[model samples]
Target: MKLYTEDPERILIYGGSRKDSGEIRGIISGDTLKGSFYYSSYGGGTLKRYPVAMLKRENKWLLGKGVISIYMGIPSYLKTEPIDYSDPKFIFEEVKK
Candidate 1:
């Protein structure tokens, strides 16, 4: 899964062999993002084991929680490339591990 954002709190998630998409919108409170999303592969599978992960070249981790749910097997709201703060390689490894 890959996560990027136009805005810090507004997120876009790309996941799975189907390459489905999802969105997470909310504010970053403490160490978590309290939001809701669609097609988020990490919502409940392997990736979900780690609710948060450190962003790439950044000193912070994006925490996901609250009503931050997801919709699968569908497309996201927008189809633009967002900022990829989280480390893709690390995330992939985290999920696989």
Candidate 2:
């Protein structure tokens, strides 16, 4: 992932697969980062946008509780579910360069 924090308060994060690219536009307030996560659908050819809030703890970005819609199947069926931040599969790490 690539992060652009030129405005300090405003941050732009970009990264994903070749078929689908993801971008996150976040606003820094205190130690929290509030923003929207955007990505392109692999099969639907549509843009998926969702709200995301993360808190900075010990240099790691921890995801806030929220529901996200995930598209499944060929025709693109959306299933909205609560995000499990405590799960190891749900990773929200900030890479340092």
Candidate 3:
């Protein structure tokens, strides 16, 4: 994933595979960013939407609690949970050049 700062307060985040990709638009304030994410799934079979917030702490980014909705498929569901920042699966680090 990559995150770009469009301005002082606006951020653009994007990443994914060849068949699935996602983008997020966020507003930054201090060390926190609040945003929404839209995802396109493989074969264009599913779409996902979610509210996301990230907090920069030291060298890592932590994902905040939010609700996600999965659509465009049968038996879609909504999930609400808090992201565990200490978990590698939920934490993000900056990409070094």
Clashing pairs for model 1 are 35-68, 38-71, 39-71, 56-85
TM-score of 3: 0.51
How close is each model in CA RMSD to the real structure? 12.7, 7.4, 6.5
**Candidate achieving higher TM-score, 2 or 3:** 3
For model 1, how does the per-residue alpha-carbon lDDT over 3-60 read when each residue is reduced to its tens digit? 4553433233444343423444445655434333444343334322112323322443
lDDT per residue (tens digit) for residues 16-91 in model 3: 5444346666689998776766656553566666667788888777776544555564221244555444543345
User: Whose lDDT is higher: candidate 2's or candidate 3's?
Assistant: 3
lDDT per model vs. reference = 0.36, 0.54, 0.56
Model 2: per-residue lDDT, tens digit, 1-97? 4343333332333345434345667689997776776666553477666667776777777766655444452221123544445642233555454
RMSD of 1: 12.7
Q: Can you tell me which runs of candidate 1 are displaced by over 4 Å?
A: 6-16, 40-97
Model 2 quality (TM-score): 0.50
Q: What's each prediction's TM-score?
A: 0.31, 0.50, 0.51
